[model samples]
Target: MGKTYLYLLIAVAFEVFGTSCLQASQQLTRLWPSLGIVVGFGGAFFFFMQVLKELPLGITYALWSGLGIILVSISGWVVFGQKLDLAALLGIALIIAGIAVINLFSISSPH
Candidate 1:
C-alpha cells in the first residue's frame, strides 16, 4: 500500500515534469524539450500503471490528476511567469482539500 502511494507520487512528479517540458517544447519545434516530453510522460504512465495494480482507478486517477493539476499550475507560475488570480488560487486549494478528503475518507483508498 505504501509502495502504491510511492508509485503514484512518482507518477505525478513525472507528469509535472512532462507538462513543464511541453511548455518548453514551443509547439514541438524544439528537439530536447520534445524528448523530455516523451520520456517524462512515458515514465509517468509507467508509474501510474504500477499504482493501478494496487488501488482502484477512481481513487488513483483522482489523486494523480488533482495533484498533477496543482503542481502543473505552480510550475506554470514559477517556470513560465504565469499568474493565478484569486479564483484560481481558491480552486487549487479546493482541489487539495478534495484529495485529502479522498485519501482520508475513501474506502477505496489503499490501507
Candidate 2:
C-alpha cells in the first residue's frame, strides 16, 4: 500500500514534467521537448498503472489528475508566466480541499 502511493506520487511528477515539456514543445515543433513529452507521459502512465494495481480506479485517477492539475497550474504560472485570476485560484483551492478529503476519508483509498 505504501509502495502504491509512492508510485502514484512518481506518476504525478512525471505527468507534471510532461505537461511542462509540452509547453516547451511549441506545439510539438521542437525535438528535445517533444521527446520529453513522449518519455515523460510514458513514464507517468507506467507508474500510474502500477498504482492502479493496489487502489481503486476511481480513487487512483482522482488523486492522479487532481495533483497533476494543481502542480501543472503552478508550473504554468512560474515557468510560463501564466496568470491565475481569483476565480482560478479559488478553483485550485477547492481542488486541494477535495484531494485532502479523499486522502483523509475515502474508503477506497489504500491504507
Candidate 3:
C-alpha cells in the first residue's frame, strides 16, 4: 500500500516536472526540448502504469487523475499566474475530496 502510493507520487512528480518544462520547449523551437518532452511524458506514463499494477483500477485511475488535476492547477497558478476563480477552486476541491474518499473508503483496495 505504501509502495503503491509512493509510485503514484513519483508519477505525479514526473508529470508536474514535464508540465513545467512546457514553456521552455514551446519557446526553444529546437530538437532537444522536443526530445525532453517525449522522454518526460514517457517516464511519467511508465510510473503511472506501474502504479496501476498493484492497485485496483478504479481507485488507481481516480487517484492518478485527481492528483494530476490538483497539481496541474497549482502549477498553473504558480507558473502562469492564472487566477483560480471560486468555481475553479471549488472544482479542484471536489477532485481532492474524491481522492480522499477513495483512500478512506475504497473497499476494493488491497490495503
RMSD of each: 0.7, 0.8, 2.1
- Give TM per candidate: 0.97, 0.97, 0.85
Candidate 1 least-lDDT 10 residues: 102-111
Q: Report lDDT (CA) for all predictions.
A: 0.95, 0.94, 0.80
Model 2 per-residue lDDT tens digits across residues 1-111: 788999999999999999999999999999999999999999999999998889999999999999999999999999999999999999999999999999999877855
Clashing pairs for predicted structure model 1, backbone only: none
Question: Could you tell me the lDDT of residue 26 within candidate 2?
Answer: 99
Q: Report the lDDT tens digits of candidate 3 across residue range 1-111.
A: 688789989888777767666755776586776676677677889989998889877877778778988888888799878789999999999998888777788787666
lDDT of 1 by residue, 23-98 (tens): 9999999999999999999999999999989998999999999999999999999999999999999999999999
Whole-model lDDT, candidate 2? Answer: 0.94
Q: Which stretches of candidate 2 lie over 4 Å from their true place?
A: none
lDDT, residue 92, model 1 = 99
Between candidates 1 and 3, the lDDT winner:
1
Query: With candidate 2 superimposed using the best TM-score fit, by how many Å does residue 50's alpha carbon deviate from the native?
Result: 0.3
lDDT of model 2, residue 106: 81
- Give the CA lDDT, 0 to 100, for residue 76 in model 2: 98
